[model samples]
Target chain A: AQSVTQPDIHITVSEGASLELRCNYSYGATPYLFWYVQSPGQGLQLLLKYFSGDTLVQGIKGFEAEFKRSQSSFNLRKPSVHWSDAAEYFCAVGAYTDKLIFGTGTRLQVFP
Target chain B: EPEVTQTPSHQVTQMGQEVILRCVPISNHLYFYWYRQILGQKVEFLVSFYNNEISEKSEIFDDQFSVERPDGSNFTLKIRSTKLEDSAMYFCASSGGTGLSDTQYFGPGTRLTVL
Candidate 1:
């Protein structure tokens, strides 16, 4: 079974500071990992995904994630956090099936 | 840019009543999906639809839940008898392909509250 774990329940960062959200996944084979952000009263937006090829992938809003197979981690990172970046982040893994297994989200709070 | 759209941002239904949540996926997408998130919980996959049939479903999608694509543009999820546990934000998503690399775009969820 595919599963995801986002160990950080909440994180607070100063505005313009670096941000890194940790994510770890479990799957038998190669996993399709994804990072999604959910703003207040908004839908889940895809930040980036790792399917194959390069270990690092860039996504919208200046976000990027590096896939580390050895550690089974695909952590999201942003060099500078903006106030609007305060939101809930989720990590997910997809297996042979179409379904996605998601982890408990991490709430990001950006302080000015 | 095309995106998935869902109706009834919030729905309040009495326990034992039926409720249907609607969605309009991206015009060109071929695969549709339904997911739910209870308060303080992770999002969960409920069902996936392709070629007008269910390709896969999670254990949470049981007899009480049903889905339909009545027309070309609309996909719907129906709860036959809403229960208190059914209270959650339901999200609809669509993907251009079923492959692992394909991205699934989500719509603003419909918050269902059963009392």
Candidate 2:
């Protein structure tokens, strides 16, 4: 079975600071990767995805992720963080059945 | 813009009770799915619906669980006998393709609490 690992349980950054959330996946073949954000009591919102082509993928809300094959990583990054960016983010890998295998999640905290 | 919608945002049930979670996917989507997230845990895949049938389902979607598209717009998940472990947030998602590149749009999840 494939699994996703987000080593960071929580990360705090100042407003306007650059942010990066680490995600590592275990799979034998090339897998579809995605980043989704969730505010309190809200649904998962798609931020970005990587299916193929180009190691770098851009997504909504000023977010991007770089897929590193060697590291089995698809880390999400943002140039500047805002207070509203504080939320729980999940990293997931798409399975052959097209179902998603998700990581535990990384809670982001932004401070002024 | 079209969005997936789920009914009964919060549901509380007793053990051994039957609970049904309802969802209405985007009108044009070709694939529909259900995923669960336990508090303080990862989002777990439960089942997928396609072509009026179950295309795939995880081991967690076992004997006690079932899914149905009882109507053109309504997709539902029924738990025949709820257990304490069955309490979790259930999310319904829909995508426009059978391909991996399609992005799945998710609905506001139903928070199920079994006591």
The list of candidate 2 runs beyond 4 A from truth reads A95-97, B98-100
Error of 2 at B48 (Å): 1.1
TM value for model 1: 0.96
TM-score of each: 0.96, 0.96
- Separate DockQ for every predicted complex: 0.69, 0.69
Task: In angstroms, give how far residue A96 of model 1 lies from its true place.
Answer: 7.2
Cα deviation at A20, candidate 2, in Å, is 0.6
**Fnat for model 1?**
0.72
**On residues B28-104, what C-alpha lDDT tens digit does candidate 2 reach at each position?**
88889999999988899999999899999999999999999998899999999999999999999988885657878
